[model samples]
Target chain A: MEKNKIRSDHPLDAMLRTDRIPHIWCPGCGIGTAFSACMVAMQASGINLDKTVMVSGIGCSGRGAGYTRLDSYHTTHGRAIPFASGMKLANPELNVVVFSGDGDLFAIGGNHFIHAARRNMDITVICVNNLIYGMTGGQAAATTPCLAKTTTTPLGNPDPPFSLPLLAFASGATYVARWTILHTRDLTKSIEEALNRRGFSFIEVLAPCPTGYGRKNKERSLDTLKIYQERTVIKNGAHPMDAVMDFGNSITLGKFVDHDRPTFSDNYDRTCRPHFA
Target chain B: MKPAVLTGEHFMTGDVACAEGALAAGCLFFGGYPITPATEIAEHMASRLPDVCGTFVQMEDEIAAMASILGASCAGVKSMTATSGPGFSLIMENLGLGICTETPCVVVNVQRAGPSTGLPTLGAQGDMMQARWGSHGHYEIIALAPASPQELFYTTITAFNLSETYRIPVLVMTDEVTGHLSERVVIPEAGAIKLRHRPAPKGRKDRFKAFQPGPNGVAPMAIAGDGYGIHVTGLTHDERGYPGMNVETQIEMMHRLTQKIRNNLDDIIRTESYRLEDAEIVIVSYGISARSSLAAVDEARAQGIKAGLFRLITVWPFPEQQIQKLAEKVRGFVTVEINLGQIHLEVQRCAGSRVPAVLVGHPGGAVITPEQIVDTLKTAF
Candidate 1:
């Protein structure tokens, strides 16, 4: 009998620790999709795997570093950016990437994220915004939409959500972009571009937490994806301030900031090289 | 080119001496936030690190500084951070993470008085007990106290070496007096300074377990970006370094974490005895208070009292055995510290009901005078 023609192997198998999977992601969670996009982007970037390190904070999305078959660190909550920055600055040859959730990155780690960007630290930060804290349960997050129902926000979320692209841009990120899980190819390409960028590059991927955010909102995975498809408008060169996310309104997606500037290490070397000499 | 270690005798504060010691130990990364008493150490490091091709990062907060050092260490470089009492409290959560991950790093807490930032510029040993039990978990720690600038210089190097050797975070618990007091410190040649590095795993990289113990019960470390593809987590993990939440796994992990330091207590614990052989009254002290205790002991000796000083060089493993043994020989024990009865409780616990233990301590803002310690010594009898 002839063997089946379809290939069973996955392209990301070599880049992942297969023994640790099936992963801890919920059945309909979009973090898996975002994580896969990142893996494929790293592969496409053609960077040295041995010289690449992934750092993550405490959350469901933080598990990306553990699953990746690379030099990775699972750091304390809200600390992945600084940890990755240390790796990048200590040895400039290492390719450092921080993968964590919006709650971890924006709430507790917000200062680190903004400061690193302002300093133009040479690192890639891939933040998966699931609108809620998935790992600790369906709690309200810094990225949760206004009027959204969460465990912490039982009645309704009164606080306005952060415009991640605007924050990254305002904080001096040399490269900034936003995408959703529905736009897999664009998200993958953006990550690849961010990986090759010279300064602090940030890509915020809006993902669905079906078990946490979706369960409370009474929306399924497909419904969330449909919302992304219907609301997101691609505006590559639009001003960052105009890219705010209002769940009922339009959500702008695409690279909002791309500029050339001296990174933290480059400036340090320029200023301190004479002293060393 | 400027040398990493400045050889010869020079007058410097304990904070500067500690920075020099870190440089001499080949610490390539210094990540810290500026807190009073400890801020001088960070300032000194900022100026010196770049000269020696080292990295100095002023992290946004103490927690981030702690996390940054752990990351740099995991990247296979010796790393450290310095802070004060409030900052130390901020670092406790990540300090536990560093312990659970078995990352090698040094945390220097140049203590100030605090229930909540009581006195930032004054001297206090208020963090002694907190250094031992600050992080919310059950794990053995190595902490050293330096009474003088000279001791600070040497103890900082020892702190780095012990952290690397044990694959755990080591604490250098200094006080405001020791940290700011300027004194002469002798620096040796870099070649003569002893250093220890984290050993690499000896097995195949693919099959290597990140937390599997070697002969010393410390798992050989594989640095980040070394192609080991290892996963490290703060949660209780097995030998493979994967998170395992069951009771059995928790027991095994906790035992290994505690046993590594407990089993090797002989090598880790250090204490200095000044005329302790034939003394009836013993003063148990550390940090700046140890100096005052020494003066009091000498005055007592001149007046014909059988008094001696037991200075704690390594405060954490408590030196319980030596204290227990000394309790059997001495009539009473007095602990002199800046805070109110921190280490005195430990002395009392060790001395038990057989011999009485007294405390010679103050609130903060001032060091305990020799007269106060002498009064306590006289009253103890």
Candidate 2:
């Protein structure tokens, strides 16, 4: 009862594993900010918190599911979406959420993301786009910049980064958005909106991996936040094609897509279960 | 307009029977990828699961399929996925995850020849040993090899039952011969068929340890949305299911994950003995080879040679005790399989110096005929 009182006063406490507090994310990391925003959204979403399950793949940001007090799953690398998709399909009433980093969601798990979006499965996916693989040290990721120095790309990356919003929109993500940790209120609101909506909703939050990406790039955590604040523009209804991220140039951030077709379950129920219906 | 049970005699393929068995076992979710020989199981599930309001998802690949089934199982659904060798190889990564998380799901591997997509259309018992040690790490697992369509039907349900009972993934290691061959399968009434649901969490929901082993070292699983607010991970952790990175945590976690199956080997391991009471030569086999072994045993007996069949129904946690006892009584043993000598190695290990274990096996393209086994036993053993 006393613990309940303390948690009620701190709304987000109820949605966190207080015992598992003091998470593994390093200080000055933007993941903590983005994660806080997510917790706030889930706490205030008004949906059945008891029924919501969080799933994460392997990465530093993949630990999101571990800290949450909901029925959470920290699945294998690149399997969070599929795992959560399985949960949503098994029981359509339950709210399934996938929370992980870009390397997990976009690179290794890229196929699942596109297919799940195409099927329009009702699950909210939050991708922490730190532009590098943080968990496995400062490695070059699929979202790594064309010329970024990292452990693997000490000579500078020859590959281009993916425009995640463009990918999500092209892959049929019903609700697409991009925000940074600085835009916590918007990120929270976007998550809250995705929580209430149906279909495969995706939000890519550009967070700073100070220890991984930042250390090699010569950008301190503060400098990274400064870039997010100054170098990014929020164009709420802009075309996803323009929602690119090239830290040197301007980055576009906003809710890029919000429309729904028949979800996988909707199609399943419509095409199947005649006598049961 | 078929019900999930379809409780009657139906002359169908083994794949169809396996699907029906899953439905009868109350498997509410199936996520799978379509591969040869195993494709029929997915097709059968696609047509049947919807009729029963069960979730059927054809995932992009075997990895996604394996991962999805684990997800559904975590949500309190009896889930399954089916595949062949190529697809089975892809499922290995998440299979480890399922093991570490102690997720209860059924994975059916309709064995075909493979190093990498070796013989797609042919039946092979080559994956029997793969079913034992394919996943990374040394963790105990339950795998059943059914010889016929009828046995496939019962074995699948038994797979799910053991999976739920032990809170671990069970493999229905049927081959393309057993999976594709059409045979008479009598589906018992729903009430008659046994089912094992995972024990539910007890006591206060807030303090529930998600990985705490209950009566039989199997933890009570609380599904998502049940308000138990449990956390499950593929990382090494304690009963609370948090990531505990240390030697002690690894030792404790590995013990619980593995010992659950090891301690209950008597319950988890199952086999069939035929004419072994007064026999001298014992023929050990599983899956399609077991069918041939049974015939070989009969043929050997008719020829005035004392031979009996020791058919391994549950191949993994390899029936050591029974094999050891047989080795003590029998003069020599013939380990018949489709692989070069996978289960034959296990047979040799169990048989020891008391009896010699000979392999009646080949790199599989076709089923090992009864004549081949009979010839092997007549000469080799």
Candidate 3:
């Protein structure tokens, strides 16, 4: 199937299965870039692609599951975490990954996010922070940076944005990282690291929604990628406390935290063993 | 004729037996909150599931408990959740999702009083109607009522089987009294039990469509990330699984969903007829109330009255044809229930104009006594 296809000049073309192409992504969408990074990361990690189950919630980013020519599920909005948690417990051998948008993961599913992290379930959550709701036509999202213009936030958003990596860290995720689309290799490495991690791993990739959010904020097309790359700084020996100062404009984008905690299922199995026996 | 084997044994209440029945059904995962009489079932599952390498999680609330079980079921496990009226009410929305998504699982409702926090520990069968149409939208459901703990255990197994066989949610609707009652239920050996499995779609890679129904109208369910084109949504979906957004598609989807159970009603509905052979007075009942009706039948027969009991094992599909045929021979029908008579209406509908069907109602925590049923029967006669 790979040898027969006419490869487009797009760098992502090599990683994507061409037959499943004519992708659902809109023109100038950074989701495609994120998708490319995800594919590269999966390919690089040497994890069993066949055993990898992708669970996604409702949103533009949720469609990532449908595009991946692997075993994936497009679940109900904001409900992918529980489903992914179940899959991991059912088959500890299988790799479970949740791909969701900012709105899907943080706003509506915020409660689930914290608890799943707190329990340290063995799963990877790759949150695509687009700053606004893209599928529903540029509504202000939980991560829509304050003063950023959206259809819902025409005069600019009054609500403050969420620092996703710090939130995950506080919620007890064993691994937390952030990256932008421009740093393709960095984003891939973060995803690779999250997948290989044994406990709940969360990665927030600042993906540009060139059509809705990007156009409204006056940073449309691939130019948004350049802006993100220039504005974000990679921090070495960074603690989650550092994220507090960089909230407004400058953002820290790198492997922010990586540690260990007993996963929910592992602890549950241990606690329940004596009773079942 | 051989002498009749008169074995009338009274044992512990129904609720205790229900707990034992769940253990017998091989239920390993139970996610529920403690609500009234239903709490015993949860307590039992909590204590027992671990012993069998099963899981029991008392979620923060009933909504999560219901949703979590649906998730666990998708992960290829037999799971259940137990609750009363309030908790059951909270689960209605997800129950509808369970129907549309075709997730196989069980919900045990130990009936309690009222619209809101009725009688907390009290008994009432008010949830009878909720079990059928409590969930939003139009979809079919399979419900069962156990008159004994033996039936509770057996019905739970049957509930699991029906859920798996049809790929739909099954409700084990036990009233507060039955949920609390205990009895000597014979646990069948593992080999003697028949476990139903749906048609599993083969070929791990992309050839599988998760919602595609087989010849039996039950589509094979694959765990998420099984490397298949598995797109499940709460929306009206086509066989290919992308959203179908058309009137024709909606109509076709509803028809298939409704017909899957309606067409298989014969195999799905089960009931028991006691002394129905030559009886002129028939009392139809189910759940805990059936025990009272059974006693009423015997008392009426002792008084030279031609009386019998028709106990419903499968409550939702409502053994219509059998009741319609029985109505031909019976002079009158008495429907006894714990609620202000829900299943009685179903019996009345099935009985048609063939006989006068009267309801002996008790819309409270107390069980409908056999004397009350006998009085109604005598008055009708």
- CAPRI grade of model 3: acceptable
* Candidate 3: segments with Cα more than 4 A from true spot: A1-24, A138-140, A145-161, A210-227, A244-248, A274-277, B1-23, B202-206, B224-231, B240-242, B247-252, B279-281, B301-307, B327-332, B351-356, B378-381
Ranking of models by DockQ: 2, 1, 3
* Top-down TM-score ranking: 1, 2, 3
**All candidates' lDDT scores?**
0.91, 0.90, 0.79
Task: Residues A119-213, candidate 3: write the lDDT tens digits.
Answer: 88899999888888888988998888888899988899999988888899999998988887778888898899888989999988887788888
Q: Model 3 residue B44 lDDT? A: 65
- lDDT tens digits by residue: candidate 1, B133-186: 999978899999999999999999999999999999999999988999999999
Q: Chain A alone, TM-score for each of the models?
A: 0.96, 0.95, 0.91
Model 1, A1-277: lDDT tens digits are 2576777677889999888888999988999999999999999999998999989998999988889898788888899988888778777889999999999999999999999999999999999999999998999999998889999999999999888999999999999999999999999999999999999999999999999999889999998999899988999988999886866778899999989899988888777655653
lDDT of 2: 0.90
- On residues B1-381, what C-alpha lDDT tens digit does candidate 2 reach at each position? 777799888999999999999999999899999899899999989999987889889999999999999999988899999999999999989989888888899999999988788999998888877788888888888899999999889999999999999888999999998999999999888899988888888899878899999878888998888999888998899999988999898999988988898889988888889999989898898888888889888998999889998889988888898898888878989989998999899899998998888999989888888898888778885
Model 2 lDDT per residue over A49-152, tens place: 88889999999989999999888999988889999999999888799989999999988999999999999999999999898999888899999999999999
DockQ of each: 0.72, 0.84, 0.40
> In angstroms, how far off is A54's CA in candidate 1?
1.1
Error of 1 at B343 (Å): 0.9
